[model samples]
Target: MDLTLGAVLRRGLLAGLAAGVAAALVALFVVEPVIRDALVVEEARAAAEPAGAHEEELVTRTTQVIGGMLAAVVVALCLAVVLAVVFAAVRHRLPGGTDFGRLGALAAYGFVTVALLPGVKYPANPPAVGDPDTVTTRTLQYFSLIAAAIAVTWLAFAVRNALRRRDWPAPRAVVVSTIAAVTGYVLLLVLWPANPDPIPADIASLLWRFRLASLAELAALWGTLGLTMGLLLTTRRTPATPATAAT
Candidate 1:
């Protein structure tokens, strides 16, 4: 099968559709409920405040729910576009025996660098949990951690490649690189500033559930993207379908 820019994009869009739908469903069913629970706490808090102190919402809840689902798809598609282009560039060099394996590895790398590590450092909160004044500080911290994680990943892979180029054994290269990555991540986690806004203890359980659900939705996106693309590739390789295209 061809791994051309066009072909990979076509495949990626299809896979992304599957991924987006999966994530959207998770957001709607799992995360949304948690969000509603948080909103209830928020409403109660607002009720306790002086009248007219709280701002009225311009958008209705139903609209926001539908919009959230749509946003998930848009984000997933955008991320998939990035994945498609990146896979095309690094397809040959990725450490995998097959294209599927390579794509899966890339997706896993993305999940770690782009989603998991950063999320662990700064878990998502419900709309009402944080101090509004610290929004700028929190945003900067979150993106900074994401950048740090990606940099660490790149350096780790670079070190691994350097070792391989120096005639180091594959296992040794992998082990050394893995150690570097773990150490770098640990340092970053320790050094990066914690979320400035404290989690509200009143709704701690709801917050925990919401964070977990958010992670689950993200995991579903990447997992589906990888698996769907792999299945598509596998289908093309079956005996029933003769595939002969440039890779």
Candidate 2:
């Protein structure tokens, strides 16, 4: 039950390792297949177009798309490492057998990371698409948002056990994680130029990109959370076997 700096560091490192492995596996098996299928469909559509459209143009577009996807993947991996460390460190400061509380804290942390930050940065609009014809873009945007929400949820549960036992002040981990995530997001947005031709003309387009970025961030946080929780839960003491009745 002793919460020390060394314990926190050890837990964070272990969590980050586990999260990185899990995120990599998921990217290879699940996310890759889906991305590949989308690319194939896009290729087919491009192929069916009239001749003299310049196949090289299509190739260039495809390359850009792939590059963006890969960049997103790398970002996700990094996020996982960071989140794992943060969650592990926070959990280490809390008391033992506090899984439920840990989860609650994580969920709060996620909300702060995803919803609160964006709400602060951008104005809210009616959650509706401006153009019905841009369904593909809208769908991708929503998909990214859902993925982000799921990742946050996963992180919340991972830390639930640890949070239950701690007397740490409310919103500490959540606030810190949110600030870190937002700061990182702003830096990336500023340092990296915007796409010359962004899809969708209005709020929907912005939301879509926001969703994608959130998904990456959430993945990183959850990956770390999973690793830390797994370690704590597995290494904790187990109850002794019951005494045998007289034969």
Candidate 3:
């Protein structure tokens, strides 16, 4: 079968849409709730009070936060799907050069998702130490692990794209992009600090403040990955002309 740019972009959009929806569903219904429950349990334990004392309050608050977050994620996913479909249609209609429209759609989706990260409530666990330094360290460590996982996932996609194209000449672009993304994330984590307060006590307030920073970091990673892949896939040598070939 002939491989057209339109077809390629359509596939990419479909893949992205599917993945985005899956992630949203899991994050909304499963992961967030589990984390919230764990956080509540931890909070209750740390308080050295009966869980029943604050069970109702905890449930109500967590439910409200999780509900709002789920709604936001659903909205974002819908927007992403709509944008992707539009991009695919446009690319199909205007078949000329490789479609960067799909890349733009992906970037937009990623941006929206990242933007919501600030609203994500980290479960409140008792601070291991009363000192702010320990809290800071723990926060950094957790965020670092999360950032690393995100970076690794992006790199995996890059590698998969390269493999699909059978253009393993040297993944310099991928390597460079990955390094830049990781660096940006690390810098953001260190320079832009969030409050050391764990969970419900600090979660809601910090969500808005730190959300943008996290989004920026995620945007850097997404931009790096998308741009690198776009560059590699779109830039290719032209076919030799008859005169040049004869020589």
Candidate 4:
């Protein structure tokens, strides 16, 4: 398609930034309120205890809206940059290079590695959930899972490449690699510590809703970015007809 690296990065980053904005909108309008409600419930339960410094000045509705939106944009921008780099890195590894199929696969890979796998190990919790003291520990666990997921993906690629070199059938190599990645992921899920903070049954519904919202938000971001990149690439690859070229 004669696309340069700079063009790819520029387009990918723009798409990602746009996707992040869209995701933040969903979070601000849909997810944050539910989380806020959940926090209220928590606050009532802890009303009697002397408020710790961390607990003081709970995230107000206004701050939630403003902060959530800003955070979403910033996070999306950063995430998009990284995803763009990853897309470039894996472009050659993908069959047929940077086609729509490759774009879709990259998006799916990003979602799985960045969101699903890590979330499975440490799903997003409501604001009021978890021990404040363990914030550092929990953060490490979550990021560690992310790193592990990336490692597992890299390992799958390595396995596939090794098998391919050994004259294994393409289909067989893919299957074996898929199985290896899944097995590694499952093991990570089991070995990792999930959210252990007990939630009452009543708040379960809210928590469930919040988690779903969180997933939807991220899915939306990746979906937008993927679709945008696909469109951009397709447009770029389109041939100019005689009439169009003359014009």
Best by TM-score: 1
Ten contiguous residues with the weakest lDDT in model 4: 238-247
Candidate 2: residue 165 Cα off by (Å): 17
Tens digits of per-residue lDDT, candidate 2, 1-247, equal 4444455455545554555555555544445544554445456656788876534554564575455455645654454445445556666443233644553355345545554434333322222323446556645544455355445444543443334346434455445444554455455334432223334443454454445544544454464555455456446553475324411
Top candidate by lDDT: 1
Ranked candidates (lDDT, high to low): 1, 4, 2, 3
Better of 2 and 3 by TM-score: 2
For model 2, where is the 10-residue window of minimal lDDT?
Answer: 121-130
Compared with the true structure, what per-residue lDDT tens digits does model 4 show for residues 65-177?
A: 88888887788778777767776776766643345767777777778888988766777778777787888888888899889889998898789888988999878988998
Q: Which stretches of candidate 1 lie over 4 Å from their true place?
A: 234-247
Better lDDT candidate (3, 4): 4
Worst 10 residues of 3 by lDDT: 121-130
**lDDT for residue 194 in candidate 4, whole number 0-100:** 70
Compared with the true structure, all predictions reach lDDT values of: 0.86, 0.48, 0.46, 0.78
- Which model, 1 or 4, shows the larger TM-score? 1
Candidates' TM-scores?
A: 0.92, 0.39, 0.34, 0.85
Q: Give one digit per residue, the lDDT tens place, for model 3 in 1-247.
A: 1235554455444444444444445455544544555565558566897555543454575676567455544554454455445444444332123545445534543443343232232323222213455766756645664565455435544553555357543355446544655554455445544646444553454333334433433344345434543443344333454223311
Per-candidate clashes, comma-separated: 0, 22, 2, 0
Which residue ranges in model 4 land beyond 4 Å of their true spot?
50-55, 58-60, 96-98, 166-169, 200-202, 237-247
